[model samples]
Target: MLQEAVDNFVTSIANGEMERSGGSRNTIMAYRNDLGQLCSHIQTLGITSWPRVTHEHIGNYVRHLRDEHAYRPTTLARKLAAYKSFFRYLSQKGVVTTDPALGVCLPPVERELPQIMTTEQVQTLFQLPERDTPMGVRDLAMLHLLYATGMRVSELIALDVEHFRAQDAAMQCVGVRGNVRYLPLTSAAMDVLDRYLQHGRPHFLRDASETALFVNHHGERLTRQGFWLIIKGYARRAGIEALTPHKLRHAFAMHMINSGMDLGSVQELLGHAHISTTQFYCQLASAQHR
Candidate 1:
């Protein structure tokens, strides 16, 4: 009887959710799974009717998920959402006097720390690209600059050839909304940039007037998505499970903070609008040392 009610409720919402979100079969399946577990929990207690299930029963079930099952806060929150939706349906159909799941709050979503690669892992990724070939030279330079400056992928893709002031060994980075910052590059990164400009960039630039620093095979400006694909390919080759442009940026910030670089300077280099944003990396660096 509890299973029948669960099925009906899931079927009722599945169509509407699918129509609205498109391809929401997975979400509907999650709701079904949540209610099935609820039914199993109450059945073990000898409760048979939908109306016999009380608010206390719901609380016990949630506690069981948290304590016995050891579900993460995120998974618990998602289950709570499913519970609320299910009880809301039952309340509307007069099966329950009140919505048991309504007043129950979702678990707080924890903030995930940034993913940082080890110095050895960073070296492994950087060394994957063949420095001699044009594509390899371009990718290697971009990877080095990302780790060197902690710049956003958007800023990396938006780079222009003139932005690389090789004479100063610093990049003239132009951010969104006309904001500009001079990102000091390592002498090594600058050397690669010089090589890319001389041997690599010229080979990629089909249009003589093209000003973009990085170009695709079609000779158009390289996109953020393109850079992401490049990173993923190198990561796979280097045997890293997960890699993204932001991960590289996070790694750069972590390394800088670990090296005793002041948060203010790191903030300036990364072009962060707030000092608070830069402070998170300090915690990461401290935890790593401990």
Candidate 2:
């Protein structure tokens, strides 16, 4: 059956009803529903069986839940746990050649970081902006994009519309001596960017000729100082007097490291020219967790 594994995976965590997984009965039921929804989704992609599922398919499903349904990080984490269990069972039974859900990354757990914003603080700052106003929309976009990309403030302000790839949900960053890197956007960042591009940017544009993706009240490319003020304004409102763009970048790097992202991947995402530059985050994460 196309949906057989979804059903079997319910008690698969325990191997059978007699054995017990630490998860409660309700969690097993929730896992069953989660896998069932995923199966229903993939079948629409013309797959007649679970054996055809790929890592790409699982990634797309996660992105769909993120971008289309706007699932929160905690909710996504639960669904990912369900996927991992179901796929583990599938792989053990030879129903699939390999585990397709092995690569799905859940959010870094909430933890205390010395001299860094906690996950709750970050969420507070992100949710502080009022999205209805043009400036607010732009601010939220910048905040989300900055946190999502871990880009320097100068780089963020330097972006043009052409640098963003809407279909892939990524943005290009040009660094020293014309070095170029493309960074993937989080679904939250993508959603805010789309809203800013479609609704907010128009209000700030004095001329159609302006190509800057982010603009100030005068309809010109935003300066680093301008971005500084915008961020400070929000931070002050949130009672965070010491906030800076670099702090956000630091949080992004260390959180990824602590969440088990490889150092090479972190280096690439941060556009660090040397792996050595990215290695400190490992120590930093350890220190924070300690």
Worst 10 residues of 2 by lDDT: 14-23
Clashes of 1: 0
lDDT of the structure predicted as candidate 1: 0.84
Using TM-score, give the best candidate's number. Answer: 1
Please, what are the lDDT tens digits per residue for candidate 2 over residues 33-131?
Answer: 788899789889999888788888999899899899998777888898878877777777888888889877865745334377778878989888889
Instruction: Give the poorly placed runs of model 2, Cα more than 4 Å off.
Output: 1-114
lDDT of 1 by residue, 164-279 (tens): 88888899998765789999899879988989989998887789999899899888899877888888888889988878888888988887887888889999888888999889
Tell me each candidate's RMSD, in Å, in order.
Answer: 7.6, 19.7
- Which pairs clash in model 2? none
The whole-model lDDT of each prediction reads 0.84, 0.84
